[model samples]
Target: MHALVGDAVRKACSELFSVELAEGQLQLQKTRKEFEGDITVVVFPLTKLSKLSPEATGEALGKFLTEQVAHVSKFNVVKGFLNLSMSAEFWKGFFAAALKQDDFGFASPNSAPHVMVEYSSPNTNKPLHLGHLRNNFLGYSVSEILKAVGHRVTKVQIINDRGIHICKSMVAWKNYGNGETPESSGLKGDKLVGKYYVEFDKAHKAQMKALIKQGMTEEQAAQQTAIMQEAQEMLRLWEARDEATIELWTKMNGWVYDGFASTYKSMGVDFDKLYYESNTYINGKEEVEKGLAAGAFFQKEDGSIWIDLTDEGLDQKALLRKDGTAMYITQDIGTAILRFRDFPDLAYQIYTVGNEQEYHFKVLFMILKKLGFEKADQCYHLSYGMVELPEGKMKSREGTVVDADDLMEEMATVAQEVSAEQGKLEGLPEAERNQLFHIIGTAALKYFLLRVDPKKNMLFDPKESIDFNGNTGPSVQYTYVRTQAIQRRYAEAHPGFNPKEANSEGHTLSTAESEVVAKMYEWPAVLRMAATTYNPADIAHYSYDLAKLYNAFYQDHQIVKETDEQARNFRLALTYKTGVVIREAMRLLGISMPDRM
Candidate 1:
């Protein structure tokens, strides 16, 4: 539609003003809601060529387009804006064509850029949390959106499985667990391990307090705590591959992996490939040595390797400590290099990380580029804002964070409660009811998190997200279900009804119906914009608007019972197209729409 309008505007200019305008010079936009048109032409850009006032230029172009363009039925000049209303016939044909497409809004797979998205890098010490939920949804949705627009996307995550954090969980579990496994305790593996992590903190804090009571400074006390020292020694032993330490680490991490798999399944997010820090940290150390030999990094007398990024608006950062243990960036550098090597065709590598590490990514990318990895320029830090509860910021060590598993269970419980009150699916089988609740609850969670702009902090409210009337996942899902109900009844009344066989030519549409069709026409463009910005919020809002328009049309017009055959068929076709688009849009956000919710 945009291409058609662009060509019409260029032709109008050439014939009326004898001016040839480049495509970029001819600015076009959707007509403002208050305006009486489907597409708007910015007349101010062409006034110089026409040698007339803006309004006069708009009038001339509008007059020419109305006569020359077949789809453009009429036009009106509002100051410098030439608003053009497309023909009703054009909209009817547009919706009919849409009904024939299986992949309505997605572009065909092509030779576009192959991109890699990295997200959900959870630590093995604890279960996933609300923060991880946001990261996973955003990364997954962005990958899907990219694919929708013809980019080849690879979903990947680098698990932080080997670190001081993991060691903390192991050290506490071994000392105090008494061999309490997940099976014996009736707890998920991640939750069971997290309990020990909290225990470790409590014990370490107690020791620090005792040392402080002995007149030791806080720093001195922190270093002198027995629990802290033991954890540190455990880390050393694990790094040295001590048999006992390795066995303990392996057992605890296996539990975490099992727990994480369940949570990820419940969350409905997945990765195509997984990278482990245990496998990548050694590569990072080797790379650091190579950097040192190449003069890209320097080693101090204390045996710590450092990169001088002071000239890059940052202080020097350590690559390796005196004990030669790798830091966060060390593994990240190694993982990135390994990814590019594994997928040499990758044109972009996006790291979906929290904004707190913005500087870390900057230094990593700069170091990579300095070491002559020219592809480092293609690295993108998709820095998103944090998710905080209404009470306050979360503290993992204090165990205040919202556990992802618990939150999901709560959402399902809330969903079932809301579903029963609404009485929409009461007659379904128990198993189906349970499945619907899971779908709606998970969709609600994903939609609420993805609806906000990625760079903005969001306050998640479980109750608010599951509402049936407002802009939410369930509302959109309900609208789709409503459409399905209409289809079912229509089929009952007219058996063997095939929409493709129904003739919709020359059907006159009411204003509300036309509005619905107009919004549907905007889907492809909205999808493209979402892909370009790498923000699922764009698709989320678009889905809401499309659903809202369909609801309004459903309320104001007749569908299954309309006496007029042409009007009823056209409405059914519109309904069918709306369902397809809603499902597709929600799918791009990693959301599922239940058929009967």
Candidate 2:
């Protein structure tokens, strides 16, 4: 409809005023709530073509559109704006057609350029945390949104498995672990490794304090600490492929992988591909060598490799240390290249990392461009803000961060308690009841995290997220269930009823119906906007608003008991369409909806 109106306005200008208006010169918006029309066209820009007063220009365009556009029934001019209303037949036709489209908001699958999204790059030294939850959900949701809009998306993650961080855990376990495995300790593999990582930190700190007491400076103490030295030596040995160090590294990383698989399964996120630093760092080194050969990078006196980017408004960045170890940016470079190689038709490479690495990505992308990769300009850093608990921020080395698995379990527990208090799903079989709880819990978590704009920091409160009344996911889920209940009752009372026989051709819609139908008309545009902006918050908030609109309509009207069969059937059809949209929107967010609350 918007496109149609835009074209009509453009034609009106060319015919009436003899002026050609470019694409963006025509400004159109959905009529404001205070307006008495469906679509509003701004006449201010077209005034240049008309050379008339704003009101006069608007009047001219409104008359031209009403006469020329087929679906445009009438129009009115206010100030410099021309508001156009559609005919009843137009809306009826739209609603009837939309009813048949099971995938209305999504485009048909296309052989478009592939886009790769990398996220949840976790280290093996620690378990997944709350920050990782947001990353995974955002990445997965963005990929889905892109796919829905006809982009071929590949979801991937790079495990930070080989680093000094992992070596810290290995060194700690070797020095103080009494040979206890995850099975013996009754802890998850990632958790066990995380425990040793924390132990290493505490031990290193204690050694630092002792050296400080012996009159060494803090920096001196940090470099000279016994535990720190051991960790460093362990990293060097692992790099050298020492038998004992490599064996320990392999075993510990394997344990962490098992733990990660379980957590990922529980969280309902998956990756199409997985890269590891251990595999890609060497590739990065090769790329760095190629850069040096091409004069894109220079070798320092100490054998370290650095890229001089001063001309590009950045300082020199080190690609490799003197000891020949790849830096984080180095691995990223190789990963980007490898992904492009894997998908030769790739269009975009998006890295979902926190905001702190914004500069690092800037340098990495610049270097890739300098290295003559055409797709380097397509590389983008989806930098998002950190997530903190209500009390404060989280620290992984201090073991103060909330574990992702634990937080998910806690969310389910809260869901159960809330459901029990509300007395929903009572007397159901245990398995079915538990499934509902999980669905509700997952909806709550994902919606809460995705509701806020990804660029801003958020404080996730489980209590606020699980509420049944507000703009939460469980509330949306309950609304869907309510719609199902209405349909069930309708089925029981009128078994032979067919919505096609309702006949809504000439019926005048009430205010509630108009509002809801208007909202439904906005879904395709909203989804397209979300895909363009790479923001799931757009979809999340739209779902909430749609649910609220349906609930408002539900509250004001009695569906099954209306005396007019046509009106009742139209209301029932509205409810059905709302349910379909809610289910589809929640699915894009990676949330499941239960049939009953």
Q: Where does candidate 2 stray beyond 4 Å? A: 390-392, 397-400, 461-466, 493-507
lDDT (10s digit) by residue, model 2, range 288-383:
999999999999999999999999878988999998898888888898898888889888888999987889889989989988878889999998
Across 137-237, the per-residue lDDT of candidate 1 in tens digits comes to 99999999999999899999999989889888888998899999999999999999989988988998999999999999999998889888888999899
- Model 2, residue 16: distance off in Å is 3.1
lDDT of each: 0.88, 0.88
lDDT (C-alpha) at residue 464 in model 2? 55
**Distance from true position, residue 263, model 2, in Å?**
1.5
Best by lDDT: 1
> Alpha-carbon error at 107 in model 2, in Å?
1.3
| Candidate that scores best on TM-score | 1
